[model samples]
Target: MTTTTRTAVVTGAARGIGAGVAKRLAADGFAVAVIDLDEAACKPVAEEIEATGGRALAVGVDVADEQGVQAAVDRIAKELGEPTVLVNNAGIIRDNLMFKMTADDWDAVMNVHLRGSFLMTRAVQGYMTKAGWGRIVSLSSTSALGNRGQANYAAAKAGLQGFTKTLAFELGKFGVTANAIAPGFIETEMTAATAERVGMPFEEFKKAAASQIPVARTGRPADIAHAVSFFVSEGAGFVSGQVLYVAGGPKA
Candidate 1:
């Protein structure tokens, strides 16, 4: 890839929203790096992009691990060109009420969501600064506003908003734009798991969630991807430090 060819690194890209984002970026003409905890798991996504005549690389990394994240970024730079777009979407949920949440649960969620974003952003900022153009999108959630049984998740998601705004303030002059996307009730494997965890039938959960959304339907991965695609577009240079709520309705 040439310097003129934009490259993107998307964490947790083996499936769900991350996978959707990776595919969308590739379709938008980016050389995409599909990153996940298991490199092998990223192959299908990467292959799908490649099969569609787009460039892609699969990278295995634990986003929460500083050394691992640094190494992954370095490898991507060497192989795919200096990545100018980053999607810090790797996350995990440890759902429990504050009283019942274990210390391990809180720490695990914090490490993956907050600490992972920090490490990945720190590692990739140099590349972005060098390129003098970059797009950083972090996945937040409506849970950031507060959710039952998600004290740890809520705090971490809220932290990403502050982190994104600060990054935009600091890096705007360098041609880097940082933004957050807070999705509400997206239908994905994660949400399916949530349904099971709460002992509700998946279809019933979707119906219940849909009733609350103004659009009268649950969100899909592609909906969020469309928002991300716009944010990373070259024309979006003027749009930064914004948090887009991709729920079916006004969250506030």
Candidate 2:
């Protein structure tokens, strides 16, 4: 929110929604840090930002690792200036019916979606508070409402809604706001994987999903990005502790 140097850090920015968000924030005039587990995978996104005459940095980090997350944040602050905007978009899916789910599957989802968000937010909040202004947006999903094979994912995402609200309450005095975006049926690599897991062609899966939505179309990464852009914008300072359902219909 500071006009001097608005650096944004977006996790899982190598591809999909994270990448889209990184690009959008860059265009919004923030010095963006494109972070992913594979630093190499993050290069293309950062490079694309640079090509468009925006500043960006590619950093490799496992968001659930305490040391890794702290180190990545320190580096971003030094390289791109203090990160006042943090997008916790790094997540994984381990979908299974409860009877078929393994403990590992459950832990994996929690570690990435819950623990990862915790670590990343902990690391970045200091800069935001120091700047006296910030925005934190975590990606939730319609699955948080309950999906057939996503018990673990649903729990983790639901947990994030609470996390965002708590952050909003705790950080409001520092001019920091936190909100969650629960997207529905977004067309991304993750959704493609879901389609494969369900033995449906990706195109057919999109069509089937679109048919049930009021918008009559599957959501795109850019759609999520647009919502995020609003949350992080200067005008959204009063908005916090909200879970925005970006589903095509009235899902919330």
Residue-level error in angstroms, candidate 2, position 76: 0.3
| Cα deviation of 185, candidate 2, in Å | 0.6
Steric collisions counted per model: 0, 0
User: Which stretches of candidate 1 lie above 4 Å from their native place?
Assistant: 1-3
State the C-alpha lDDT per candidate. 0.95, 0.94
Cα lDDT over the full model 1: 0.95
lDDT (10s digit) by residue, model 2, range 1-252: 444869999999999999999999999899999999999999999999999999999999999999999999999999889899999999998888999999999999999999999999999999889989999999998988999888999999999999999999999999999999999989899999989988999999999999999999999999999999999999999999999999998985
lDDT of 1 by residue, 91-159 (tens): 999898899999999999999999999999999988899988899999999999999999999999999
Residue pairs in clash, model 1: none
The deviation in Å at residue 57 for candidate 2 is 0.5
